[model samples]
Target: MLIYLLKRLLMTILVIAVTSVIAFLLVHLSGDPAAAMAGEGASPADIASVRETFGFDRPIVFQYLEWVGRILSGELGRSYYLRMDVSDILADHLPVTATLGVMALSFALLLSIPLGVAAALRPNTVIDRVALWLAVAGQALPSFLFALGLMYLFGVYLRVLPISGGTTWAHFIMPSVALGYYATPAIMRLTRSGMMDVLQSDHVRTARAYGLSSWRVVIRHGLRHAIVPVVSLAAVQLGFMLGGSIIIESIFSLKGIGYLAWESIQRADIEVIQAILLVIATAYAVLTLLADLLNAALDPRIRIS
Candidate 1:
């Protein structure tokens, strides 16, 4: 187990290193950061001064090494637009993003699990068909469009929810629903399939033969077994949620890292961009690791192997 963990940790480190290099290079390749910051009307000397200040004058390799070194030394650099430390900006924004992610995940789980289990319990029935159709619709619709529709129906037409901005729990309802609804299909499908398989298992058959209550057989025996796969799906979805937040946050005008990243990109704020990507990659890597650990814990065969 220790060796497996160490191996995964090493792999995660390598992935982060590779991701950092790719992110840095991609941003640089898109345009000269210094030139972008200096603007079009700037004179030659102005460009040169800006380049020197930002160390864009250095060789790419040296620039990367310097950036990495500064990162190691706890300097994420200042945003070109905000003229403030990227770390400070991230510190302020992370809580909002985290809170939003947690709420959205909660909403997704609450919406998916019961519906999926019910579908599995009575396959080919009206309830199951309706759930499946809803799942299909969720999978088909894009999150931004879904959000807009919700805004129109709940916010504009009914005036029951705010269309944009985060001020209260009501403000979170639309965007969280948008994000959660988009993710529900995957969870629902995974749970339904897993539950069906678990229901047909020998253990479940034995439990039924032993006169266990239907709900007990389903919850105690089948639900427990189904959870492993559901958890794996949940972890993957959680990581995706972090990445997908950019669109939802932008649509809702939420004060989160995703919003910050979007604003940073508009101003060519490389520091914030790099910081956001690095943080998000790290989060994904960690979530994967946690999922592996959970899998091992749930299935002893994994630990044995």
Candidate 2:
């Protein structure tokens, strides 16, 4: 297990290294950062001043190495538009997105796992049909539309939840539901299928033959094996949530990294854009590594493989 973990960690570091290069080059490849930073109608002198000031006049490789050095030193550079330290901006906003991602994943797991287990236990019955229908609907529905519906229902009609801002937990409820619902279908389907396969395994049948209660057999023997894949999926989904929350954050007026990304793009803040991409990519790689370790813990076969 230790060896397996080390391999996964090394792979994650390599992935992050590749991602950093891509993030650094992406803005440079688009066009002159100095021109974007200087804005329209700027004179040639202004552009030159901007370029030289930010070291954009340096070789691309030199710039990249310097950027990496700053990142390693916990400096994310200054935003082209905001003129503030990128790291400071991220520190202020990262927690909101992180919290939202965690809440969204938690909601997905809490709702999907039970539904999947129930559906597996009662195949072809009404409970199974309802769960399947929900899964289908979740996948088919657009998240933005779902978010709007949630806002209208709870915020407008019921007036129980706030429609915007991230000041309180109530502000996150609709956004979390909207964001989490997109992931629910895949998780539910995987869980149901895994449970169905596990329930039919010889070990599960032997556990039943030992006169264990149905719930005990299902929860203990069945779910233990069935949930391995779900752990992997959850990690991937969480990374997606953290990176993909821009639209949700914008709609809900939440001050998170997602909203910050949107603002950076509109303003062509290259430094912030690069930082956001690198941060999100690093997060994704780290989550995947953790997932691999968790899967190895859950299923010894994975470590052996």
Candidate 3:
């Protein structure tokens, strides 16, 4: 198990390294940081001054290496566009997105698990059909459009929830619902399938033959093995939530990392953009490794493999 964990950690580090390199190069090459920082209708001298101030005139490789070294040493550097510390900016906004993600994930699991279990328990029944329709609709609808409809129904007309600005718990409801429902389809389908397969396994039959009650066999024995794949898929879905939060955050005006990314893109803030990309990429790598570790812990076969 230790060996497997170490290997996974190494792979995660390598992936993050490659991602950082690509993000650095892409951000630098995408647009003129100097011009963006200088604002519209800036003179050539103003642009040159801005470039000089931000070290834009330096070789790209040198700048990238320097930035990487600083990042490794726990420095996010100052934002050229915002004229503030990049780390400070992220610190202020990261929690909002992080909280939203956690809430959304929780909502998804709460809804999907029961629906999936029900569908698996009574396949081809009304409950199963309802679950199938939900899964299909959740996947087919765009999150933003879904969010707008929710906002109108719940926020505008019903006045039960806030339409935007994730300040209070009420404000968080719609965004979390919109984001969480987007992930629900995949989870529900996978869970139902996993449960069905687990139930048909020899172990399940043996447990049933041993006089174990149906509920006990299904809950204690069946769900244990069935949840393994669900766990892995959930981790990936979480990464998607983090990445997809950009649109949701914008619609809701939440001061989260996703909203920060949107702002940085509009202004072409290279420093902020690069830092955000690196942060998100590292999160993806770490979460995937965590999923692998969790799977190995739950099922020893994974570690051996």
Candidate 4:
């Protein structure tokens, strides 16, 4: 297990390095950063000065090495537009995103698990059909559109929730619902499939033959076995939620990393954009690693590798 964990950690490091390099290069590939900063009206000397100051005049490799070194030493650089430390900006906004994600994920699990289990218990029935339709719709709709419709129904017409912004629990309603609903389809499908498979397994039949109560057989045998896959699915979905929050956050005007990313992109703030990409990528990597570790813990066969 220790060796397995060490190997995963090493792999995580390599993945992060690759992600950082890709993100950095992709941002540069679009055009000259200095030219973008200068906009359409800047003189030749202005562009040259901006280039020299930002080290655009240096070799790409040198710039990459220097940026990596600074990042390693806890310097994320200043936001080109805000003129503030990137770290400080992220620090202020991280909690809001994290909190919103937690709320959304919790709601998704709460909604999906029960619906999935019910669907599995009565396959091909009305409940199962309903669950299937929900899963399909949830997967099909874009989160931002869902957010807008929710805001209209629940916030504008009903006046039960806020239309935009995430200030309190009330403010979290629309955004969280949109995020949770988007995530539910994948989780529900996984849970339903896992549970259905477990229900048909020989072990379940053996438990039933032993005259165990149906609920007892399900709770003890079916749920435990089915949960392993569900947990893994949930983890991957949670990681996706972090990235998908950008659209939802933008619609709601929430002050999260997603909102920050949107703002940075509009202004072409390279430092903020780079830092946000690195942060989001690192988050996804860490969450995926955590999921892998959890999967290993849940399945002994996995830990052996």
| Index of the highest-lDDT prediction | 2
* Model 4 weakest 10-residue run by lDDT: 235-244
Model 1 lDDT per residue over 1-305, tens place: 88887887899888889988988898888988887889889988998999998889889999998889999999988887887988999988887677777778889889899889999999999979998999999999988899999989998999998887787778888888898898898898888898999999999999999999999999988987887888877877887777669999989888888888888888888888888888888788788788878888877777788
For candidate 4, write residues 10-78 as lDDT tens digits: 988888999999989988887889988888899999999999988999989899999999999999999
Query: Over 4 Å off in model 2, which ranges?
Result: none
Q: What is the C-alpha RMSD of each candidate to the true structure, in Å?
A: 2.0, 1.3, 1.7, 1.7
Against the unseen true structure, what C-alpha lDDT does each candidate score? 0.86, 0.92, 0.89, 0.87
Error of 1 at 86 (Å): 0.5
Clashes of 1: 0
- TM-score of model 3 (CA atoms): 0.94
Candidate 1 structure lDDT: 0.86
lDDT of 2 by residue, 1-305 (tens): 77878888899999999999998898899888898888999999999999998899999999999989988998888986777999899998999999899999999999999999999999999999999999999999889999999999999999999999999998998999999999999999999999999999999999999999998899989998999999989999999999999889989999999899988987889889999999999999999888888878778898886
lDDT of 3 by residue, 1-305 (tens): 77887889999999999999999989888888899889999999999999998899999989989999999899998886778999999998888887888889999999998899889999999999999999999999998999999989998999988887877877888898999999999999988998999999999999999999999999888887888988888888888788669899989888899889888999888889999999899888988988888888888788876
Clashes of each: 0, 0, 0, 0
Sequence-dependent TM-score of model 4: 0.94
Candidate 1 regions with alpha-carbon error over 4 angstroms: none
Query: Which runs of model 4 end up more than 4 angstroms from their true locations?
Result: none
